[model samples]
Target: GNEYPEDLAALPPQIIIGAQYVQAAGVALGFKKKGAKNVAYTYTGDGGTSQGDFYEGINFAGAYQAPAIFVVQNNGYAISVPRAVQTAAPTLAQKGLAAGIPGIQVDGMDALAVYLVMSEARKYSVEGNGPVLIETLTYRFGPHTLSGDDPHRYRTADEEAEWEKKDPLVRLRTYLDEKGLWSEEQEEAYIEEVNEQINEAMKKTEQAPKQKVSEYLQNVFVETPPTLEEQIAKFAAKEEA
Candidate 1:
């Protein structure tokens, strides 16, 4: 049986750094405690694993035997710092052992490998056992963020070329072409249609009305308190200024 919808249309994208896994662990624990038959998982980057909240969350889950899957995308470097500098451990996967969680490593560059690992992780967690930790060995081809970091400063062109050979999309396309399952024409048309759809989506969102902080605040309480009402008015005044 599946939990929620496979498409995940109900769960919108959220951006909360470091503390995200903590929140996820709590939700998973809640579900398991209530006897909900489902698998819960969360993802964090290599650098995020250094945060204290990350350990706290996993520890809590392991203690209660909560069904949660913690996935760490261990790209060689976390921002400007190499994985070596982050920790002395050979692999991030072993960190879960301290919390009584079973950890596994996988080749993140291979999409099929990732799928297989996730499939098993879900089954193990959903059986009311406990949380599982997955460490993915991968590389980040581009800059860490939109912050305009020049990766050349830390890594060399030779190293970049080495990783380029393992590009998942390129490898997958090559395999598909060999099997006569894919063609360049199909890829081109698919890309063009996808770009057009994305453009239309951007235009539609741009035409949407702006949201106010008060709207979110009001939704929290059934009856708004006077203080919140006053705060909302203050926020409105500040926006006008």
Candidate 2:
């Protein structure tokens, strides 16, 4: 969400995530003022954490005792950039200590571990213990997005193969299989069910009417400003001409 205000002076305290460190911290500060018992959680990749805003957000949260959980998903690489080039810091969690907030590094591949740690952190915040920084050491198996390719240029095949062995899905499946909770039939059925659900969602999305250009202008203000009205008139005149 675009939490940044049009006037920089009007910016609220938040916890900026991903590439939005400043904005997220602004939202977190807002939560602090609202007397929130639970911490406002914001996630950011390793690369994004390198930005000034990330550190600033953490510092502010700690200073004000804002209920904020800063989660760093260290997936080894930020798009094409490897972690080696990202930061010299040995651990992302260590960065939190500078802000006087406890930082915990957890095995991101273990779903239960992450859940438990986060749950405990939430409890600590609710009890007026302040913010916690959690660095989840995970891996991104797929491309950064549909547009990007496997980041093999900076990463070695051996490294990729090693991390693949520790894949969260594979580990979880293995654990379930050991407990007799997973079988070939069950796996197939689960895949089929998920595929059907995804296909239905896609169909609905595709069938939905596309947003018009005018819709963008409508949300910019509660009522059109004089400048916006003039621009709209000019746009209409151009269309007519």
Candidate 3:
């Protein structure tokens, strides 16, 4: 489900914030149109919220009172770009206010807190209240992507060390441990089970057949237009050669 768009302008207005934003807004809009008595929710990162489409999408939803919940996962950096560089606003949630929507900033590291805020927001939307924005303050533990710039260049070792101490996973595990629901043995067992599952899946994937050369031409059109047909023919001819 993780994919990227080659063109930004070609996408639907609501999706202009990229795939994640688009998906979230779509879900919300669907709920609204379906006459659902509940709110629809979607989440995106701080970096994504910086996009122009993000504001437009939220504005439209707010203006129409579309029962939607927009959540911003503000993890300090949008890839290598810092939050300060992304926008001038003091908080991402405040941006929602400009569109006549209520926004709340919450500690994203606290799972219970986030859940509670989301639950209340959903309740409000279900009651015919307009859209609400929730900005979650958190940090990413890994590099922006599997292959990308190192975070150490922008953040000092001390800063990262401090964030590590406040890691959500660690905090949640600590809470669970306190409740006697988790222990070292439990952690090890979970990790082992997950690893085994991952390995099995990987093996299955590797054994799957490689796609045929013609497969690339299959999904481009439902009823192939003349131009596409020509292109497909050319591709097929080249393959034959």
Clashes of each: 0, 14, 0
Give each prediction's root-mean-square deviation over alpha carbons. Answer: 4.2, 6.5, 6.7
Which predicted model would earn the best lDDT? 1
* CA displacement after TM-score superposition, residue 75 of candidate 3 (Å): 1.1
- Expressed as tens digits, the lDDT of each residue in 1-241 for candidate 2 is 2243333333333344453544555556666565554356778888778788888888877887777788999998888888888888899999999999999999999988999999999888657777889999998887787875767766788888888889888888889999998999999999999999999999998997664434445444658999987877776666557
Q: lDDT by residue for model 3 over 2-63, one digit each (tens)?
A: 12222211223233343445445555565666665656567789998878767877887887
* Model 3 ranges with Cα > 4 A deviation: 1-19, 188-241
Q: Which ten residues in a row have the lowest lDDT in candidate 2?
A: 1-10
Candidate order, TM-score descending: 1, 3, 2
Q: Give the TM-score of candidate 2.
A: 0.70
Q: For this target, which candidate reaches the highest TM-score against the unseen true structure?
A: 1
Candidate 1 colliding pairs, count: 0
Which of 1 and 3 is the better model by TM-score? 1
TM-score of each: 0.77, 0.70, 0.71
Pairs of residues at least 3 apart in sequence or in different chains that clash in candidate 1: none
lDDT of 1 by residue, 140-235 (tens): 999998789999999999999998999988888988899999998999999999999999999998996776665546543558899999998888
